[model samples]
Target chain A: MANLSALMLARDLKLLLEERSKAVAYTSSQTHSSLAKGLGILGFHPSQIRKVTCDDSMRIGTALLRSAIEQDKALGKTPFLIVGKAGTTNTSTVDLFIELAAIAREQNLWLHADGAYGASALLCQSRRAILCGIELCDCLSWDAHKWLFQTYGCGMVLVRHRQFLTESFGTTAEYTQDAAETGESLPNFWSYGPELTRPARAMKLWFSFQLLGLNTIDIAINRGFELAETAQSSLEGLKDWEILSPAQMGIILFPFHPHVPAANLDEVNMRISQSAIENNLAATLTTRVRGVLVLRIYSIHPNLSDDEMLAIINGLDQLAHLYLSRASKDDII
Target chain B: MANLSALMLARDLKLLLEERSKAVAYTSSQTHSSLAKGLGILGFHPSQIRKVTCDDSMRIGTALLRSAIEQDKALGKTPFLIVGKAGTTNTSTVDLFIELAAIAREQNLWLHADGAYGASALLCQSRRAILCGIELCDCLSWDAHKWLFQTYGCGMVLVRHRQFLTESFGTTAEYTQDAAETGESLPNFWSYGPELTRPARAMKLWFSFQLLGLNTIDIAINRGFELAETAQSSLEGLKDWEILSPAQMGIILFPFHPHVPAANLDEVNMRISQSAIENNLAATLTTRVRGVLVLRIYSIHPNLSDDEMLAIINGLDQLAHLYLSRASKDDII
Candidate 1:
């Protein structure tokens, strides 16, 4: 919902400035899929989203993004927005926001950061450097439900300029005139978003902050990084597990290859994931990293102990061996 | 939010059918302002909305709507959706939905009914006739927070064909592939709407219905009509007051104009409303009925007694007399 609002604001800004409805936005293939879906909902064609290639580290390829913008402009498409990821969903890779911010400034585009999964890292001073350039974004969307220890349905969108929200979503009606702003005070919140009668979503976050001091909150966030690193180190000790993406922002990906063909590796990893769930070991899942299907572990629970993480890894290794033996027997048959 | 989703579905349906981005929608001037705001958020220009004038009773003018559609079509605009009000906010006037449904069928347009305030009346067999043609709507947005005795932030949008929702909002990502449907059962709810992670909003409504059976719920809704009629009867006995809109669907509108000029009528009624709030008499507000600023009463509380309703009306009468005398004294000076 936060990303949807940001794209709406960007689209409205382009309409206001260039009076162009055929506007295009730039985001890497590594960015969250919700951004493309939001653009489609906002009346932009699928072709309007330029999925620029990503680097080997899974970060957005900055050169490809620049060239895509230039090409779109040459083709008479208005380039209006650049979406950068503070921490992507799949591999938790942070995009090159500094370079993207420079391009946004040069091209007069809105820079929006999808910080839903990783913005909570900003609470921990030591881990904040990875998202250094996030401050330069025109807007940032953060989800408290992800890493902020909140229940579901809590997300926030922060814009550099407050007026853009009112410009994009301000509403008035005869029944609501009594509650209208008098110009001496802030406008009613209905003007700032799509909802006219929404719950006080910030109250939960406020209560959480008041209950848990910043020091404790920062430690909780830092624990996520510690857990991810523990999972990476434990996986490195395994025989045939190849780390597809190293632990970053509480997410790590790996697959057990064991000199198997590429086609069999996906099947093997998938069966291992299914076995773990079936055996009630861990509720793990598989995701495609680069072109290979890999087991992805998102270990962000502050209460998750290091021993529990190691047990889950070892259990998955055993399941992989069991599944590989079955596959070999089938091949022999 | 429900209306916003309906407009998005309508927009996407238009895109699928005609491949036209310049689609126009029809709604009455008395329709909720949120419709226009939602269209703006969906990238439709303000001019794309044709606010057809309303009749004297505040119902949508059907002839004018037909002419407007014809005019837009002549100008090469794609008319794709028509919004009809089940019960307007100010006067609680329902539009000619039968006429609207017929027109939509003939024009091949999507018909949406804004039943946020009045859909709950469907529980009462006595009041259900007012919303007779609501079932013919391609989609209907109903808010349980109003008229249904639920707390705020409970709304539901029902589409005639469930497939339209999936076509408009179905989304998939690598991280969510494991949860994808295998085509033999129902799809995950994320495919049906913008939210991927939403609270179970239906639980509250379900609980209410379970606790208070349909018969009790029906009586509670019937009390809304009884309370409005009580207020209307009390206002009719008082001097210097005229009913702008009669009691209908739990709403009534009137102005306290005791031979006052048209210019002072708005000022006098507004002051009366303000005094009602200041004196803690009632939280009454004013709305324009046929361009006349009038006191609008939305009385749907089942527990409110007829005596209490009479007392509030008498209290507003006293405040209006006090404000009018003071204004006359100032005029003499």
Candidate 2:
């Protein structure tokens, strides 16, 4: 259903493709465009979404919100699909869930919280504020794997009401529909969402939950954010490099800068991405910036610390420095 | 997506049209008017779907498959959706998967195996034949919770080619797209099928697997099949009752004696289904032969023996005997 939710977000975001968020807390000047495309898939016309800006960074941060009120005013109920990321994937941004839930309740929208990354913080006393009002929202999607230490594809889409699921996709199969009170009494997963033959993947979460209490998970996740702060401090010495979105969990995005012309930044970044693989580093490279590519180094293991993160940063810097020195040697000729 | 599958099945069954799945999977057998609707969705026409016999169940068994060949000769590779049940929720009928897979390979068809129940028994060496040819098929779906001790929604949809998933519902997302990657590298899960924000429901299966190995699971599922067979044998002992489908898995179907009066039997079975909540027994009531209702019992545990199954059968008989005796008293008056 998160895929469906993302599609709805894409449908709504096409207007200005502005960086709109569902939450009122911590409005940013920039967010990822993936948010824009998420709104476009839900049948929202491009004209329905309008982009507004917050005074954040120019290139890296593009934060704006598509107000649900604008939708409710035009369509009455505004039957929309709203997204509230538990933790934003790119920038580790957390929108105000309580404020968004209030808006969802009053405006009559389908509020689906994308808690894929940050939801595990709910167990954290310090970060409980981040997950505020998740219960009030119509749906909450969190990735147990990203932060909660569940396996990959351990994502969730929890609908507030059982009827919403049944109303959305209930059907009877002659072959499978037992005339007895099979699902008429309870919610069958088949009627709830987009999958029928899905993996019995839920066991990982149940196992982890049983093996380690949520409190332990809470500390571990908080530790990730805690580690991010240390990483930010450690990288401050590197003048050429820039931290884009400081780590929410362990994921910290920073672009490598060479002491070369701006035109070659992209080319060098691509080289560094390949170099990371070639050199057998722990970090894999992904692009969040338009021209500038970033390498994200974050994993679930608590063993990773500031030293490991810095080693990667140092490796990238060394590679860029070498590339720039060769270029300068040619320039001197 | 399973909901859509169910909706298509429902459309084939013709009941509620509240969901998109129902709208998508409706077959021509029941909702004949909507026969061509799916083809149109797949970019085909009404005549594209081969018409099979509605009245003749024998034609549907295998000969209808032969008829599909003529259509295959013309289309080269027909985009077809096959619905097979490892255990049909109603009857527990095991479709011949290997035979269908051979025919599907010959026709180059998209064979979607729907083993929502009985497929859970593939872990059992004795029952493995029921799930044969699964790897060769284009896609397969099954729900683990129905037969296995796993929680609900632990389903699966396996695709043979990763390209099939990337192409069928390929995405055009702003955030997920790479200007450099083209159509080749790093295909996101969103492109693989449907929905964006989802849950780590996979862990549930992992938990079940960990808690109870596949060997245990196999034993449990085959035990359920054994219970169904026991019930069938006992019902066959009763001279009046007529078994409709003595299927392979947990569900048992038998008319309340087609030769005998059915009104009293219908009332008796409905009351039995209604009273099952209070009784706390093993059996439940289900209707399979259209409006005709019957008592269905399933054994979902490996520990459950033939003796226990026979005891439940005796209990159902005692309830029916009491109800029928009361009906006779009314008739005499």
Best by lDDT: 1
- Residue pairs clashing in model 1 are none
TM-score of each: 0.96, 0.62
Tell me the tens digit of each residue's lDDT in model 2 across A259-311. Answer: 57777766666666677778886445565544456666555466676688668
The 10 consecutive residues of candidate 2 chain A with the worst lDDT sum are A18-27
**DockQ-derived CAPRI band for the predicted complex in model 1:** medium
Model 1, B144-217: lDDT tens digits are 99988888778889998888888888888888878887773767888888877777777899999999999999
Model 1 whole-model lDDT (C-alpha atoms): 0.87
**What TM-score is obtained by chain A of candidate 2?**
0.74
Candidate 1 lDDT over residue span A58-163, tens digit each: 8889999999999988988889999999999999989888999999999999999999979999999889999989999999999998999887778889998779
Mind giving the per-residue lDDT tens digits that candidate 2 earns over B192-307?
54444345566788887898877777777788778878888998887566777674666667655533355556666666555554577653756545556676666677787788
Model 2, residue B128: C-alpha shift (Å): 13
